[model samples]
Target: SAIYLWRFGSIKSRILTVCQHFFFISFRARPLVQTFTSWKAPIIWEEMFDSILYDQGHTDKNSSVALTVFAVGRYLDAYLKTFLTSAEQHFMLGLPVTYYVFTDSPEKVPNITLASRRNINIVQVEKHTRWQDISMMRMRTISETIESEIRHKFHYVFCFDVDQEFKGRFGSEALGDSVALLHAHYYKLPKAQFTYDRNPKSKAFMETGDFYYHAAIFGGLWQNVKHLVDACYLGIIEDKLNNVEALWHDESHLNKYFWIHKPSKLLSPEYCWDQSIWDKRDILITRLVWAPKHYETLRSG
Candidate 1:
């Protein structure tokens, strides 16, 4: 009877232990979360912010925001509509927003019914034959625009790829002196697996890195954003003079920039998600999701 009771108690305890582990696993930040940088910059993530608090501050200041998007060449036709319409619906709601849309096809800019204080300025840009050139040139363009236009016009600025949809509120919580987004594909992977520009000859080469930020989305205070682009543009120009291009073009340069300067804030991968590539359980809210890619088609054009 004693042996039987002891055995039964052991089985019950083991079952309870398993159940407890399962329960905690569902809530704990699995694989560990680096929610703050070594320098004390807050990494924006779900529940780490209060939207109302952020909204109130911006509202009191009567802040206006600028969102710059490039949709040159074929990307203009395929992505501009969904991206604009979705932006009208979810992006920086209740705030004044000016879209600085750079595209080769201004005629194709969708007629979005934006809320009050929302407007678009369609800027024409030359389309590059190679997709990599198209991506790398954005920094130069953004820097120039900031010097001529955005510096005095807007209190905050954000840059985005036209090939994405805003699925949730991309509100004022993202505002900072400088903000960089964690690459959704690489955030969970070890640093060893990061695709930092490894070529010794490239300006973007990095021997070590803190985080791999996505080039598809990054921005901050207008001045800081301009500073970032100016530096990146210079690096790109230098790499060109040296007859080399970074492995991932601008994205590689972006990662290298963040490694050296470190952004004032980091947006978690939840802010820049690709549904097709990721099955991450930690993403509680997907603010923006990558639209379907026809890379071969886009490149072919």
Candidate 2:
């Protein structure tokens, strides 16, 4: 109507069309947010994918998936159960999945029932006094484990923080040579505003880069993922030797790695969302969301 009024209708009709357009905008539904990175990797958003096709492709090949999570010290009691249970319900339903749970308290690990081809392995690990060490050391631990056995068994591996729950489908649409999840908090911000470590002396320092990736979720083919974690762990160790630390610990080093070696696929902020941060009008479907921050309580637990 606006086009017709502007092209053929009288002046008064054109004026009315403009007013009507503004009135209708209040009822507008969200539009699709579909795009790709400059390096030709897709940014998977809800409106941009065919889940069934991706699922079928992997299923027919009989590919197996592996999930890794750390629930050391306080987090074992705080967030592990909810994370594991929700994952059982929504993560890669039709595929064979093995969950590698790293925890200080193996007996406390949740007894979530699994489907036909699903299993869990409890790996007891040392609990660090500082939460930061617990988070940073995961890169070293995961890389070592992958080299030891996971590389031979799993087709793909995904590492996630125990402090989140699955809210929707997180399936084979995410499969790639290398996959990175855009940080929910920084995805919308410009590169200059991204919280990359600016310290020149640190190994994780970044002068400029693409989207900042979340430390909560990262994965890919076992080999690619191993390479990523190996590189990140090396950077972390180098920083410590030089008496410096990345601003965001492992997350900072992850960002630096991605900036240099672009990921083959990218998951939108919808993959790792946080409701408390901002509006959700931008996100059409949320797959997983951050469990509320209980830093003081969880750390002390």
Candidate 3:
């Protein structure tokens, strides 16, 4: 009755009819708008999982472990070349591994059959224009990339910065349900120095020489990765809302959360030893880098 009166009646009715018509038109288009809004990088987690399992020689019944690396934008060409070579050699050799490189320059890097680049899904992340910007984005991208990998059906996921080279074995044995952190002897800091008022909601507590919570350089394992990423992102979102920037970028956020929450496992620095430090010993130095050209004699363990 109202529609009929509006369609054939006075000026006010005609105006109402036009308004109602537009409103209905917009309402009808809402689904299409939502569809477009949800569009993202073409990510098929299940398909990717299947491929990883099949390639690794894992049977249809067996489970597979996957390594996830986040390399996006214009990372150093040298680092990209070395990282690709080292990772491909280690994980792809004998394991049923699916290496996923979440990167922006997918086409630039040679897409290996064993390990391939996944589309970067996180949106509105500003490109790294300055050193400070790169530092900040590294934290955000690492968190988002880990979350993306966690969504995939894999037993384990290892997230690493592209700048590092893998010289040793990075298999399931080393990362059994715990987080592996590369101990950096050069920049070693006491646990007391790590304490901060950054996490206002949580109480600050530190023990005597508890060196475990010192670094956030490389951390992984499927469940632990998922947990850490979630914690880091949650902390970051809160910081963003409060207009607070972490001192160590996203690393600071990860440190804060992991400090309180506790990681499943903490792998020693031997797994991720920076090449510059020559005095430290023990464990295979799998990851090698040319941080200093003069330190070329340092073995790529």
Best by lDDT: 2
Candidate 3 lDDT over 156-259, as tens digits, reads 56666666767765543333344535246522455455544444542222232223343334444565666666566666566566666566555565555655
lDDT tens digits by residue: candidate 2, 119-233: 9989888888864466557987898888887988888999999999899999887776788998888877778899999999998999999888998999988888988998988
| Per-structure clash totals for the candidates | 0, 0, 4
Over 4 Å off in model 3, which ranges? Answer: 1-63, 113-152, 186-189, 193-209, 212-221, 283-301
CA RMSD of all predictions: 12.1, 11.5, 20.1
- Per-model lDDT: 0.79, 0.79, 0.45
Clashing pairs in 1: none
Better of 2 and 3 by TM-score: 2
TM-score of each: 0.86, 0.87, 0.59
Q: Model 1 over residues 68-130: C-alpha lDDT tens digits? A: 999988888778889999999888999999999998889988888888899999999888876
Candidate 1 — which residues are off by over 4 angstroms? 1-32, 294-301
Arranged by lDDT with the best first, the candidates are 2, 1, 3
